[model samples]
Target: MPAAGSGLYVGLMSGTSLDGIDAVLVDFSSGTPRLAASHHVPFADPVRAEALALCAPGADEIDRAARLSNALAQLYAEAVAATLARAGVPAAEVEAIGCHGQTVRHRPDAGYSVQLVNAALLAELAGVRVVADFRSRDLAAGGQGAPLVPAFHAAVFRDAREHRVVVNLGGIANVTDLPPLGTVRGFDTGPANILLDAWAARHLGEPFDRAGRWAASGSADEPLLCEMLADPYFAARPPKSTGRERFDLAWLERHGVATRRPQDVQATLAELTARTVAEAIARECPGAAAVCVCGGGARNDDLMARLARLAAPVKVTSTAALGVDPEWVEAMAFAWLARQALLGRPGNLPEATGARGPRVLGAIYPA
Candidate 1:
């Protein structure tokens, strides 16, 4: 595979929520890569605040964004160092690092999606070749350029006997439905933790409602939930994608019903996430035998309980039951993506992400 110079690599991801950075170590051997180790590094308070502020639309924000990007690259480098240390491996032993970067803006249909990461800075700091900006290439090829992890999901979690649905409830909720032994399909269902986390930060002065305890303490506003469910995105077909640009604080402020109790709004937002995801499954993958939930939303018991109610007959379980830690699945998926890039293999499923055809995703950067 490419003359045998490729060695180990690390993948870094900081999703829309600005929660933390997930770093994973990947070792490519015999053409397929194996996961060496993974680690999570929480964002410093000021950095997180700056990142969140940059996600929204505003003029004269590019300077702050540039600084934040450099800071993020340094943080990513530190995460790689810690992960490598935990695995007892040196950075010199690794080949390159694939960083998804923080997705500040993702608009595939407009032929661009900006993932804020400084790969050059990362390479300099980590002392390794760095592959970043994985989405724009696919968008240039007229693809949604999202749910990119489904290719990796198919590689690691596909089952032969049972048709399954893998749901990653990150800032936005996306699902990949794998048929028993054939093709796969996926798309963004709706908002996951973004709305909930933003509401918590505004109302409770916390980053998130841990285990959805705030939601559990209140009752769902049925009318509000119904109005949110009426959004056209939920009823649209697959191969679609969305981000904070469409479902952020401002959007919620304009569309979400104003209520007196903050807890009620929290409960409604949780319900909206669950209901939309369940509706997507029922409409798109009626034959799914089981649903495996992953990402940060899986930790929210209130959200999970509501999902269980919406998608009956299909057993709901966490990705942990299938040998993948829920918190690390997205980060680990990118590690697998790095391996696919090195192997010259297609990283997007045509049926899943609406790519014109199978295309090997990502580019190589020499160390």
Candidate 2:
């Protein structure tokens, strides 16, 4: 059990989409963390431009990374304040803040995963101990250092009688399979909104295709989807991880779809995501009772439809049905991770992330 009077904590996360920061206020006590409130703060145009620019492969990457880190830290601090203000909580009442930071590149196989964050600045601005850099230690330990949320998912969403697969379709789609009574397994299935968003922004002049209406309006190009699936990443065994580096715009262009219509490409990308995710689940946990979709992809009706069709025999539903809002699931996972860090608990499951062994994750920066 946690010591008495261990105050509250706030967790901040910015995913691959470069969309915004998600902050959640959590109360940690007696070994469990409960969500108190959550907030989403969209990125300003200049900040977004800077962040996107930093993702390029070129010189001065490290220098640009440093600048972006401090900028993102300020944004995280602001998000924390906003969340606390809306929750009617005082900063002094909080114990710490957990920030996942912005992932510019995640290559655990190379023994490091970079998540740009300024912990010192976050601590100074938030006036609380900040736990950040959660994935490096696991990678250093020869693990994929990803899908870290499965441990938290097992803790919060596991059911005693039914086996469940929790699929988080953020920029990259990942699924965590939790059986009624056994070890859980998880991995990045493939591209999710990243490709679709990029395609939409390029062709439709929008950040994302709302409700996947654009995709639904077009038809999937089966040849393009097949070419995409041929990428060895999908066929490789579990405990793997990927980012925009592998499945971004360049990758789409290389897959023989240059002349295809934008909506058709979106449709094919959405299908690829759904098919890869379902294939992973079918290969890993064929008996999964239902697939619970989460992350931003849950809002895409066309993606959901494709997932439903791909799932076929398996039913599909959102994490909301299991008491977790799809939008806040990742943020909540980080909050739970912070709680685990405080308890000196193992946050990564070896079976899920292919770690050498169970290990406690994250570094703590004092307030």
Over 4 Å off, model 2? 1-7, 30-33
Best by TM-score: 2
Give the per-residue lDDT digits (tens) of candidate 1, residues 71-144: 99889989999999989987777766778988877877788888887888888888877777778667767889
- Residue pairs in collision within model 1: none
Tell me the lDDT of candidate 2.
0.86
TM-score for each model = 0.95, 0.96
The worst-scoring run of ten residues by lDDT in candidate 2 lies at 1-10
Q: Rate the local accuracy (lDDT) of all candidates.
A: 0.84, 0.86
Candidate 2's residue-wise lDDT over 1-367, tens digit each?
2233655778788999888999998776645566789999999989887877767677788878999899999889999999999899888787778789998887776778788989999999988778888898788778888989899888878899888999999988889999998778888988889999999998988889999999999899988888888999999989888897787888988986778987788888888999999999999887899999999999999999999998978999999898768898898788778767877998898887888898889998877
Highest lDDT scorer: 2
